[model samples]
Target: MDTLSLTLRQRKLLHILQSHENLITGSELASQLNATARTIRSDIAAINLELKPFNAKIDSIRSKGYFFTAENGDKIRELNRINTAFFTRDDRIRYLAFQLCLTDTPINVYDLEDEMFISHTTLENDIHTLKLLYMLKSPFINITNQHSMLSFEPDERKRRHILTSLIHRHWNYNSRENAIYENEYVSEEILDQMIDIVSQCLHKHRLRMEDTNIVWLNIACTIMYERLSSGYMLPQASPVSKPDASALAASNEILATMERLFSISIPPQEYDEIYLLISSAHILDPSKITLANTCRIFDASVLDMAAEYMELLQEFYHLDFSTDEDFYLTLLQYIRFILAPVHRFSTQENPSISKSHLITELELAWAFQSIALKHAGYYLNEEELLHLAYCISGALEFHFELHPEYKLSTVICCHEHMTVAWSIKRKLLGAYEKYLKVTALIPVNQAKNYDFSDTDLILLTVHKKISDETLGKIIEISPYISPNDIRKLEIYLQSQKVSFLYRNTGSVRSFFETAYWHEDYEFDNIFSAVETLGSEFVDKGIAGREYLSALLQRESLCSNAYCSGLLFQFAMTPAKQTQLSFTVLPRRMNWRNHKIRVIVTAAFTAADRTLVFKLKHFFYRLNKQCDITNAVYSKDELLQLLTAQPDAHI
Candidate 1:
């Protein structure tokens, strides 16, 4: 399958047909697809004529435009994979990005950097961090990586899955149904190296922080310290001022020293806040940071660091400070931990590159490194600061995640049976339940004569060892391009485009929520409840009908998640998610595989979480249920006769 095979007009026409499938208006197709009606008619005629040999038919309703029957997976794959060209290095990256999204693992920036040899600057501006948009659907797939592990959100996975499915038809479709392991642990050496890099950067670099932000954080911590410590037990009297002619001289001497240190004219108001923080710590008797106090003030991740900072502070200042130093100390700690290791994005890997540009930004952040150092010499060690800047820039470049979207079709070139295809599809759906809105899975043999355009094909699995020859086939056929995925190449093309899931776990989330009540991105997993519920309507084994599930899912194409957020999910299949009853997660006796915190109406056989993304009917139903979710949650309690066995009818 290569892009060279299809004419531009033919590809455009095909896309039009896909969008308006079964009811595309002829006029609309010509207008949207930018072709004259006569030209479109000819294309349609050609398509219809092509269908004849496969014993298939094309339909044009009285008011509708056109629709094609996909007699089998081969027909659909053959119909889409032909004549596509890879054309762009960006396309390769897009492919890699898609694979990252599909994978249930943490991706490494250094690894990607080394593999692609692209500077950190390029990554930050382009494909570095995952977008915060898609959080609900694919939730991060748990997988092991070379360094630093964390969960990716659902929206990222789904989007990548869709995009991956668009190009390489038959990939890992069965992953969603099988056990998805979420443990992505890096080796001790790599993790240590990353930590060491960040530590060095933070110690020497003059970080950027606004005076107001520092003031606020200082105030917040002081207030908390007062409330938590017994220092507030006694009332304090106001201090009386002594009128002394010598005080003026003393003040002049102090001002000179202060100006030399901070490079700012002394202000009484600024000193008041700093004095208050010092005084608060001084008053706490036999002070030691307590874990209970930290829990109330910071998140789990922050609290852990807060305790350590409390110890560091006590050792540095020789004064007691709370383990939870209000929000400032802990906030600073967590922010540092999260952001510290992340160096700023750098344009070169040559290590020896002069940080002239970086120095400029640093100067803006820490003005003292100039005037203070000029007068006091060694104010903050220039060489140390430069090295810190380099690392910070590098870390910033590495911070990244994935954005997930759907694929119109994936050309699977493997010679495997349908089972492998189905398994990969399930895993991909669950993994990408967030971003990928639409996806198509196609086997390999049927792809040689196919065409994939305007399709989100998630390349989930490679049945065989993929070679350059195999990838070339996809390169010539795919339409869209993403720059992050193709950082490297190998025997097989197995990767995903990952969208960053930006979610604030605690206070930050509240602030963000206040700013924007709802985000613009749609999460496929948010509809998981519905998809899971609708799976019941697709029983092919008991019903003894092949393609029943496919037919049911297709009918739901016009829409999913009707109106409400409350969705129930169930798969109507005798060959339900797998017979294996072990949880991939290493938890014992976990409730419903541990991720489901709410009720989603799961059937016994619907073990796969991907059903969350696959079912649309439940989505529509959930919309209707949103209003009385509280009632529905309390339904079991509202009944007058709790013990009575009643009829199934409401």
Candidate 2:
């Protein structure tokens, strides 16, 4: 029997039988191997057949399971020599891909079947999967030939990509378990000699490569040259980009040394390909982000675009990231890498397919999209958006670390309404736990009895006459508080004079009056709902004719769905002053991707332009609290949840 023909499971079974001198039950074997008893029986039969050649047999009785009787124990030890079957599926794929890329002619499937210890059926399935998943997806790999034989079609750049991907997956940087030593293709002596020669050449030319990168470069070159020796020359690469002078000098010296070692002359185009791969494995230096280097790396247009994007973020968020030279330089470098012809690395899987997963990234993208299009003439895809978001997140984290005292303290008063007070407290705490804290929830009737020394701001549900001696920094608010209130609270907390974007807290409360909430309005499509609300705004002399058009236009630009079943639909830059309204659908209606249960529309005004950002942030935070929206059945319940005060600062 050929030990190379057995699977890893079958080999383990053989060793198990050889170790036990007493009778072993099938159930016991099954439990030890984590397999079914029926499977154990089948394995026993297969093992018996393989052992027949060694003058051994497993004998079974009616009441017991089985026992092994062999004339010799040495034959059992020979089975361990076949260790190839222990490879993982990815390991097998990498091995197969390398073999196919290096071979001069089509390879027979049966040869791989015997050597890999995999059944022909499993081999065929893997090939089919590789052809569809990798070959078709990549511009590099092409599967060729039919059932009798098959091979990877030859191409220069494509081969490098395949080798690089394989190297990243298998090479252990800290261990000797490297692909060059593991494979039978290249000898250890040859690989070591090549590494010494390449390292000397790089050092002579003042070029630097990390130890692991040098290993990868050596392995890649070994595969290419070995395949070249077998009469398999790679197809010439496409028109080349201008080579870096230092890299070109290093590649030339390396090529000269290889020629002396192997006794073969190299083509100039192949020399460029080697240099290109060397540069692709660049070891980035932190100093490369200097202003002088940034100018050298990116074109003027890219720098201009970065400036405009940073300026827009500053204007909107009032955070001057533009002054952070590292942020600006890094963003410029990332844009250049994104626009490069050939990626530095091989195939990458895309993330950010789910909107809920990348909240901060999506927020930044939405805020930057219009500005980007105005200056750069392109919109950021999810991949680029996530990359930019990381840069911004890092910068923000560093900035916050330096200013650790940025926080807010708040208190609320709603007399004779405990449910309203509790709901308001819950929503505020959930949304602003990172920055704002609620100090107390006081009843207006008992306002004079509570201590108000630590309170930074006070929010009341109803506007009632309270003496200045009793109230401390009080702002009357509606039970259904709007984001405008939050903005005022933030400005006051920072000790800045309130800007035009904010209104007196009493005015904000008036906008949320119960009259503005149209209880009898029929819920239809989003457009119809907006039109019905817009007409009410015009009837009350609060807005003009263009309000409906502006609201629909904003909705079309992006989905107004803030949460799973809630829509925070709002009109931007409306023709008249801002006002707030709400309409609850009697039955669910499809508004874009969301199933609309409630529509909260706001007619935005120029005076409140900065306040819109705060509102957007509020709804963005609400997107994560879908359960809060789903639990509210009546107007009062909704009001209570939205008005929940935050926790007190301890």
Q: Which one wins on lDDT?
A: 2
| TM-score, cand. 2 | 0.46
Once superposed on the true structure, which residue ranges of model 1 sit more than 4 Å away at CA?
A: 1-207, 210-270, 274-332, 335-445, 448-478, 482-564, 567-650
Q: Can you write out model 1's per-residue Cα lDDT over 295-357, one digit (the tens) per residue? A: 553355444443454454344222243322343342333233232211122111222123222
Backbone clashes counted, model 1:
156
- The segments of candidate 2 whose C-alpha lies over 4 angstroms from its true place after superposition are 1-83, 86-88, 103-133, 136-139, 144-151, 176-181, 184-188, 208-216, 237-243, 280-289, 308-320, 340-342, 345-390, 401-650
**Pairs of colliding residues, candidate 2:** 423-640, 423-644, 424-643, 424-644, 424-645, 425-644, 425-645, 426-644, 438-647
Q: What's the CA RMSD of model 2 in angstroms?
A: 16.6
Instruction: List, in order, the clash count of every candidate structure.
Output: 156, 9
Model 2: ten consecutive residues of lowest lDDT: 496-505
After superposition on all C-alphas, the RMSD of every candidate to the true structure, in Å, is 28.6, 16.6
